[model samples]
Target: VESLGRDGLAMAKSLNMGNIFIRKKDSNSLVPNCEKHGVKAFSIEAGRALKLDYDYADKMVDGLLNFLRKVGILEGDEETIESQSVYTTKEIVPAPISGFFKPNATLGEKVKKKQRICQVTPFFKSRPKSVSAPVDGKLIYLRSEEVVSEGDSVAHIIR
Candidate 1:
């Protein structure tokens, strides 16, 4: 598991923003082979609701232990692991024109199809273009940069 800010931007280590979940078996069945070589693997992506804290650390540890148990590497009672669904399809909203971006929704919030999520106002005198959600899903990422160029990714909604 790895933590990243909205828009997949690298954040300070202290900030536990979100996680990227890549399945161990989604590709070439490498996870099983790696395990034969004494390596462990996971296939879930988790996003924290807050910054790095004791609660977050504890949850991580518990998740690790539970995973080990599930794979028969550790012996223990079965525990239900709460996790977020992995989304293969993502709606990436790009800037329509060069401008300053102002966001209308918080990161990780649920958005409906066609919802207005942000606006891009050009540095000059042109009108601002409102950015809308393309699908009903969770807003996984939003650009933190104030200025954006045309075609720059502004938001990502996972469905």
Candidate 2:
């Protein structure tokens, strides 16, 4: 599992995308399910839901070709990938109330635990609740839309 994860990270680095290696596997995910049966597998999550990123698609093709060669599945010279940064999203910052969300921290920035990440003001003129980071980590995800419902995930922190 670790070997394939490193290769996946390498593929990401070779493609010039943000490199990530998720250390913990969820039992419901395909990779973990396959692992249970002694099958080596890795999953590639790319692009966005209901959207096709053409530029990323092209690079992914090249990266897959290189990966195939590296694994002896294809006959060609394989490219060596540089060391990559490994991180995992373990926590998500949720909106405290359905309201307009105002982010206090920028995405990709490192934040400390208990640092205020965003504020969600209630629609009925109530006091805004501050949403904070639960751990010291890099801000990995943030909602782009301003409006958020209570309990909706507004951001994620990966360490």
Candidate 3:
């Protein structure tokens, strides 16, 4: 198994490794072979293979329990961690079009489904395009306001 960067995929294809799991964010639903030609393709979280935090063993066990519960390997109280939340990297929102993104909400704000989250406008233009939360979540970040191209990450919503 190798890291799934651009060069890594090129190398994997050259060697004919039938199954490759690219990082979820790197995949494109548009490419048909990206799904069909590979024997298997998926993504795994970063902390799945390592300790989430070295200081707290209890937190580690709780994290493992969360995974087991997710995969149906173990079952118990559905709300074991009432305050805990987990999010994938894909939850990070990117600009749909090249523009200047201005967030109306601050980070860590609890947002409901369909609530306005941010606004974006083309560079040097006046009118803004409002971006909304697709699901209930908390705003985790607002990437700085330098410049964002189409598909460039502008914020993250942790649901």
**Among these predicted structures, which one has the highest TM-score?**
2
My TM-score estimates for the predictions, one after another, are 0.60, 0.70, 0.44
lDDT at residue 149 of model 1 (Cα atoms): 98
Per-residue lDDT tens digits for candidate 3, residues 1-159, read 234555444433332222233434434553434567765443322222343635445544555565455546777632333333334332667787778777778866888877887878887778888877777876766766656788887777764
Task: Give me the displacement of residue 6 in model 2, in angstroms.
Answer: 7.3
TM-score of 2: 0.70
Q: What does candidate 2's lDDT look like per residue over 1-159, in tens digits?
A: 364465566654554335564757778889889989999776676644677879878877887787777777889878756665567555878887899998999977889999999999888897889998999998867777889998999988888
Q: Answer with 2 or 3, whichever has the higher lDDT.
A: 2
lDDT, candidates in the order shown: 0.68, 0.77, 0.58
Q: In order, how many clashes per candidate? A: 0, 0, 0
The TM-score of candidate 1 is 0.60
lDDT of 1 by residue, 32-51 (tens): 67767888543433444454
Better of 1 and 3 by TM-score: 1
As a TM-score, model 3 comes out at 0.44
Error of 2 at 8 (Å): 8.0
